[model samples]
Target: MSGIKLICGKELDRVFRDRKMIFSVFFLPVIIMVGIMSLVGNLSNNAQKDVEAHTSIVYIQNSPVGFPQFLKAADKDCKIYEMSDWEKATEMIKNGDADLLIKFPENFVDMVSGYKQGDVIPQIKTYYNPSEDYSRAAYDTISTGVLEAYRQSLLSQRVDNMEGLTVFTVNSDNPDMVIQDEEKAGGKILGMMLPYFVTILLFAGAMGIGTDMVAGEKERGTMASLLVSPIKRSSIVLGKVIALMIISGVSSVIYVGALVAFMPQMIGGADLGMNLTLNPKQIAMLAVLLVAIAFLYSAIIVLVSVFARTTKEASSYVMPVYMLILVLGMTTMFTTKTPGEWVYAVPIYNTSLALQGILTQEVTTMQYGITLGMTLVFGAVLIGVIGKAFESEKVMSI
Candidate 1:
């Protein structure tokens, strides 16, 4: 026990005392999170602003005498193009030269007046590309203006002629929506992101310390000094794993903290902390899972680095592993539904799914148990593999 503590203290002091370590572990992740969020927020705001500022040009086919004025009054910035060739105007709208096209049937005004006088109402076609945001905006605005005019005309005639009288009035009561489990805007965003966020931070933390402890020591000819010490190899491995876990855990926590603080502000109308819910068991299980993830990643990194000749070689080997982790972490981002019961047993896949479920407040205790149990088993297996590597004298040769 004392030997393990001795190695743990030495490694911890070596890492925490270094200025480079402090900057990399602490400040760098914060900088990355802030920079990425700023860029996304700026780009989204700019795109929406551009869509809103664009003016729609309307191409009218066979418009009545006073119809153009009504169109202009509804959208003051609109420019009306009267095209006698209906096909040409439609082609213009399709080709993106015009934002909207309005076509009126023959005798548009007479038919409308006739309809108001108890004749069948004719259909007016409003055309715009639904895929284009600007076109959709134009369609909605123009349609609203036309529909409002039609409705007012109908009601005005009813009151003036006293022909139709309404006994019941429509009373709009904006009722509350009831849901089984409600997720806030912020919780949704955080749930999707937390898996990836923690994965990246854990990898970052592992990459530095794992390579330095194994490959760096090999490169510096310092592994011999540690190998000669009269201590159990398992204890040495344990101490290193524990120290790596601490460093990596700290890095990830820093990232999660920054994300939680900024997420609500970054995502409009989001209340992450205020509206979030997690059962005590779920929280405890999640914490356990995180610690287990740290251990698993650290053990794998150290095992790989232990075989490398130098820090550069260790980095080369870990790059693909990091990439794999990234690809796996992103699997839950778009999924609207949680994974099935059986999937929670898969290692990294389970972590992402558990996080998704937890954030959305949808996970069951059994699912958390499955994830936590599987994680412990995986970490234990890795510890055994790494312990054997430590015992083998040839492993230090690289």
Candidate 2:
């Protein structure tokens, strides 16, 4: 245990001194998160502003009518561009010179009056470019305004005459169904991103530190020198595994911390209205899950590293494992089906799924215990296997 601690300290110092290691574990993730947030925030703000701006629409009619006055009165922000030719109006809209093009039927006034007097309403034909998002929104807004004006005209005519009508009461199981939109958003973002981020950072940290411990040592001829030392083979394996776990664990913490720090800003500026802040209990759960993930990934990476003749070979060997982790982490995004108990026994899958639950504040004690236990058990088995590999004469020769 003392030897393992000493080795862990040495490995931690080495990583701190290495500029490349520092960038990979800390700086890279921070840069990526901040850059992505800034880009998304700018795009969202622009979309909202564009939607708010009530730009000019070209109206084409065969005969003069009062409908134009109704549209103009609907919103003070609206700008109406009246045109006699439908073709010219359409061309303007298509060329981005106009926001919208409206065409009124020849008998539009008669049709509206007839409908108000208990006649069948004719379906109004509206043409819009489905490919344009803003065009669709503008069409909806204009249609809604026109309908409200027509309803108001009808109501004004019937203001002096009224009749009593029967009213029915409704009974509902969900009477006060108020959705806390903020909490829902927080839960959704955490569920979607937490697992993926944890898996990626864990794999990256393990690969970075594991390569140095095994293949790098071999290249430096330090493995041969270490073999001649009076240390037991199991102790050497233990030491390396501990060191790898520390590096992976520290990286996971940094990645998660970056996410937590950005959550308030994300909720405030973005549509996520969640009044969420992580408390000590949630932090503790996340810490435990991170530790378990680090241990499991470290053991697997060390085993893969032991089989490699060089750092390049170790990275190649680790690629498939990393891909598998990515696929499992993304399982939550595409799946609505609940994972079976057997899935909780899988190493990376268990930790990632559990971390997702923790972040969303939906994790149960039983689920957490099962995931943590399985991760530790698998890690122990993997460490035993790696220990045997390290003791082998063939592995030492490589």
Candidate 3:
């Protein structure tokens, strides 16, 4: 145990003493995260403002007597044009010269006013390019604002009471009607985004430092000297693994912290509702799960680093593993279906799933146990295998 601690301290000292390594691993990520995300948020806000300020060019065919007046009153930015030629209007809309085209049936007002129980109904048709943001916005504004208001006016003219039409309303402007865990709301949002990033970062952090630790040492012939020392092989493996885990864990924490701190500002200052009120148990579970992920990732990276003869070869070998981790992590983002409990036993994917579950406060004890136990068990087996590899005279001497 003392030997392991000594070697671990030495490994940590080597990294900490180097100022370049410290800045690159810890500080650069914060700068990048802030710079990139702030740019994206500003762009998004500017685009939204531009779209809202745009004047929509609208062509109305067979306009009702008060329809144009209603439209102009509702939307000051609507540029109303009366055009009877359908083909010209269609061409104008398709050419991006116009944002919307609306055609009302002849005698639309008369049809509504003189409607009987079994009469023909008048339908209004709208044409717009769905691909164009301005066109789509125009359509939505007209449909919900002008057309809906006009329809309501007609309904009032025909019926004595409009309230009879609504059978029931959900929530009905009552805030108390909605049942939600406000504390867990942010968890859902984080669950969707954080799991994938956490999985990727854990492995990426391990890969970045792990490759140069063991494989680089071998390439530089430091492994030969270390092998000749009085220290046991298991202590070397444990020491290196512990050091790698600590460095990668701290790196992952910094990265994730930057993301959380910068994300809200990057999204135009929108309220993320990330109210975290975690109890002691939840915090403990989260810590355990994160430790498990870091350990598992460190072991895998070290295993690959040990098998390879050079840092470049180790990097090449770790690429496929990184890709696999990426794919597994993304499953949390795209997958909506609830997975079976057995899924919790799977290594890379389960950690992501478990992290999501923990964040959302929906993970069962059984599921958490399965994921944590399997990950640690796998990590331990990998450490044992790496220890044996360290013992191989042919493997390390090369």
- lDDT for model 1, please: 0.78
Residue 338 error, candidate 2, Å: 4.5
| Model 1 residue 333 distance off true place after TM-score fit, in angstroms | 1.7
Candidate 3: lDDT of 353?
Answer: 91
**Candidate 3's residue-wise lDDT over 84-120, tens digit each?**
7889889988888999998899988889888888999
lDDT of 1 by residue, 1-398 (tens): 88789888888999889998789788787887777776777677777777778888888777777778866776778888886777877787777778888877788777765665567776778888887778888888777776578546645744775335645555445355434344454457678888988887788777878888888988999887888899888888888888888888777777777877666545543223445656686577667778878888888788888889899999998989899988888888878765789999998778888887777767788998898788778877888888888788888875
Count of clashing pairs, candidate 3:
0
In model 2, the worst 10-residue window by lDDT is 160-169
- Per-candidate TM-scores read 0.82, 0.83, 0.92
Top candidate by TM-score: 3
Q: Report the lDDT tens digits of candidate 2 across residue range 302-389.
A: 8998888888888899999889888988887665666677777777777877777776677678888899999999999999999888
Worst 10 residues of 3 by lDDT: 269-278
Worst 10 residues of 1 by lDDT: 265-274
Candidate 3 residue 261 C-alpha distance from true site, Å? 2.3
- Model 2: clashing residue pairs? 182-273, 182-274
Backbone clashes under 3 angstroms, per model: 0, 2, 0
lDDT (Cα atoms) of all candidates against the true structure: 0.78, 0.73, 0.87
